[model samples]
Target: MRQIKIDYRRPNPVPQPAPRPAPAPNQGRPPVRGGGTEHPGKTRRCNRHPGVHMVLAGYNTEWNTVRYLCPMCHAMGLPPVEVATGVINAYFPEKGYGFIENGGPRIFFHLSDLATRFTPQLGMPVTCRVEANDKGLIGREVTPR
Candidate 1:
């Protein structure tokens, strides 16, 4: 009978990967919109919904104030900003989408954004509230003037 060698030594420890370098402060972060720095002490509560926290939406250049939008109010189709007057720049009845020229920039709107049951015509004046989404600015609660 052949006798086998009995090894009782512990195995070597596995090598670990090198620690990743720490990222610089806000290095990869996207630039803040509205061209203003967030103030830590600024009020975060929503005006309409006192219990809810409002999101930093944008900066009002004219008013020199920060604009905040309440997520609840926005979800309910409530205007986040003051009603803006614009004219229908483009419309596609089949596509159900259009753009409005409101002096600063063209605001995109969908047919469902209309407040009344009326066909939008070219150059038609409209009042709408601007809202921010993943795709940038969009007009909501559009009302024909």
Candidate 2:
């Protein structure tokens, strides 16, 4: 009978590759005020309340831009408007339509109804003159405050 001798030695561990270094700050586009590019699903600082981050409240269109709201501003409301004061509840830049929240029902508005050339954003404070039409309440002469 022939007996075979077996060596019980462990093999040496394989070397791992070094991790890649992180990208430089603001490598490409201009640095955002907060130090990074705006990302989807990330909260942004409120224009009215710089210290507060806005929340995603709702979306007007199925695939359009999502709307944002400031908890403090929404709760406290903006300054009184001779006609009506409200926040831009929803805005669809592509579709040229949006809604305003003025304490009652949402007031419908359109790009043509806007008195200013600047575009409207969600949660923007605005003043509007509301008028009743066959379709319902519509906002006219809408201007950002």
Candidate 3:
């Protein structure tokens, strides 16, 4: 009978570079834009939806995400701001939808903005916020009333 031993381990662990020095206080702080110079009453534009609202809730550094309080939601509280209750003038399920506010404009709603799980029905009342795009005023955050 014979016995033999074999070694398969590395002699040393890989070397690592020295840690970087901590930056000075406010050394790398980003510049503040549209602040201190702009009108005091005016709210800053939201980063996520530009030219909309700027009621900031807070920042999430871990996900590099920002939580902004919807200005419409904040101002109106329970009822969404600028929400127009209207009856569906035309709605083709899984296609396109449009509604006409009482004595107001007839805004078009896309299938993508539907927040309700149920299919839209014509002549049914709906609550939604009218948003403008390149095409014109369209409905967003749409839901059945």
lDDT of each: 0.64, 0.60, 0.52
**Which parts of model 2 have CA positions greater than 4 angstroms off?**
1-82
lDDT of 1 by residue, 90-132 (tens): 9999999899876555688999999789899998877666776
- The order of the candidates by lDDT, greatest first, is 1, 2, 3
TM-score of every model? 0.47, 0.43, 0.42
> In model 1, where is the ten-residue run with the lowest total lDDT?
7-16
* Predicted structure with the largest TM-score when compared to the true one: 1
Instruction: Put the candidates in TM-score order, highest first.
Output: 1, 2, 3
Model 3 TM-score?
0.42
- Candidate 3 per-residue C-alpha lDDT over 1-145 given as tens digits, one digit per residue, 9 for 90 to 100: 6443333222322212344466567555433222221222335453345767655455333322223466654665632224444567887665566654433556788777877776777776665555556765577777665
Better of 2 and 3 by TM-score: 2
Runs with alpha carbons beyond 4 Å of true place in candidate 3: 1-81
